[model samples]
Target: MQVIDAMHKITSHIRNPSKFSKASKLALQLIEAGSVKPGTVSHFFAILEAAMSSPGACNEPSVRADYQALFNAAQGVTECFNQQQKKQFDIWVLHAVVANDLFTDDSFVFSKAVGKIKDAISALPITTVDDDNDEAAALAAVESKSGTTHNNTDDNAQAAASNSLPDDSTHAAASNSREESSDPFGLDGLLEHKSNKSEKAREKTVAALNRKADEDESKRFLKSQREALLKCLEIAARRYRIPWTQTAIDIFAKHAYDNMNRFTMQQRDAITKLWNSIKEQQIRRKQGKSVSGKLDVNAFEYLQEKYSHEKISIRHAVGGGGERRATQWLG
Candidate 1:
């Protein structure tokens, strides 16, 4: 009943029908049986089924009918959801896309399929809930830090009452009450003195806003950096004939974050270094016939361990081979 699992099975069936026919059939049965509630799950089931039944390789001319079916199903799914839901659904679709290596087919049709899904996702308006929450939290934090009270109902009600005063007598009475409240010696007025406190509060509030702005800028920069790194990694993987997995991607993301400044400043050099290490690992892996052949996983784990221990070796790339206790060297 898991939509992603179904997607994986469907795409696997498309890739190797004979090997995965049972898995694909079971997945379709679970999805089509109505055991799961109808909305998003059903829509995804339709898309999966369409992909499963596709006639030819995604890049081939014979696959047009199958492509059309998938495209129509995706379109229908996109049309049924709001901006937020569509974005979520689009992410799920991307997971399916990556899980099946759909876009790695080196075909315009496969890439176009991905592009269509992205276009559908991009058509939706962006949600501001997180931004709004961040701002609200910043304001609240400043207020708390400044020991400022946010409750203004009484002050607002008082202003409203003054504005609603009907006659001169009522206005005079309100004025007297205001005068009494303004008296420095009065119990309420003692806390109402407009001194440097207001200026200090304003300064703190401004500082908080400035800090929030800086944080947002940092986030944007980090996002761009990560995207660049990921794009470069994907291209490098394709070039090296390596199959990347979600776990590998996650590891790369963490490594990129750890070395954000270096990666951002010299992306090519950084990626080249990382890729060289991976290539070395793959070369080492090929020597042993009994070795597990999950090259990407092994490479990723090697990088993860190397970086985590601050003992990475780039000398292997330059034919300088010596290892420290912390550095794991390939034989």
Candidate 2:
């Protein structure tokens, strides 16, 4: 019989074993004796069913005996095949076994067996078409070229600068207020006597306050930008079927965090303008009509220019920008 026809028969026997008990028994004998050819569908299916099925009262000892017999029969057939073909056959058998529901109840034992089968296949030195080593190597190359070494020095400097600025501003403001309060004379006399000195002090204090506000705003803007970048990374990962790993997420997060200050003023402004344009375009895209030609320009390019100075990775360049990356953790 043809391999496909024989496989169909074997599958029918497995699905309704009691109805084909006599024929199954005879087929089992033929398989165990190695009288049937290797790679015949019936031979493989009979072994697969015996391996997966529960050993009931009438079938228990007979099935066990048949299993050992088939194993012995397979030894000669396996010895005749090349190492690559053997590995391929082993994987094919494993896939079939995994797909069968009969082994689900015996998962622990079956899982261990599957592991052993994989280990044996791995030892065969045959490279499969879908091996992941290439992708892993590519990612490693990108990481090396990206130059994302974390340095605590930059963080410490920023923190020290942040802490010192606020204290200095508060002290200067307090001193000025106290001096102004000490002047007890009414309007004109006090104003003319202290006007020049007070104006100089006020100017210094305002400059300090402006400096502190700029620092605070920059910090906040960096945080918001980082959050948006992460959201975009997650969406790209999902679209590409990449498995989410905590280590990968943290690596990307650290890269984003460390490089936050590298954004140029122009890039930041471009990003803001891009987001504004996106809101307008989204309304048009949803309404099923084109908007102004300016809004029709590449939104991605706009985001790239906005975030380009921040050294964002290609992985984070999707899902309406960084917002998608930030929210992926929730799901």
Q: Per-candidate TM vs. native?
A: 0.28, 0.21
Give the TM-score comparing model 2 with the true structure, all chains together.
Answer: 0.21
Candidate 1 positional error at 247, Å: 23
Q: Worst lDDT window (10 residues) for model 1?
A: 322-331
Quantify all predictions' global Cα lDDT against the true fold: 0.38, 0.38
146-204 per-residue lDDT for model 2 (tens digits): 42322232334444544443344454675577666755565545544565465455556
| Structure candidate 1, residue pairs in collision | none
Q: After superposing candidate 1 on the true structure, give the runs of residues whose Cα lies further than 4 Å from its correct spot.
A: 1-106, 109-178, 181-200, 206-210, 213-270, 277-331
> How many pairs collide in each candidate, listed in order?
0, 7
Model 2: residues with Cα > 4 Å off, grouped in runs: 1-24, 34-76, 82-85, 97-108, 117-331
Question: Which pairs clash in model 2?
Answer: 228-322, 229-322, 230-325, 231-324, 231-325, 231-326, 232-325
Question: Residue 103's C-alpha lDDT in candidate 1?
Answer: 34
Highest TM-score among the candidates is held by which one? 1
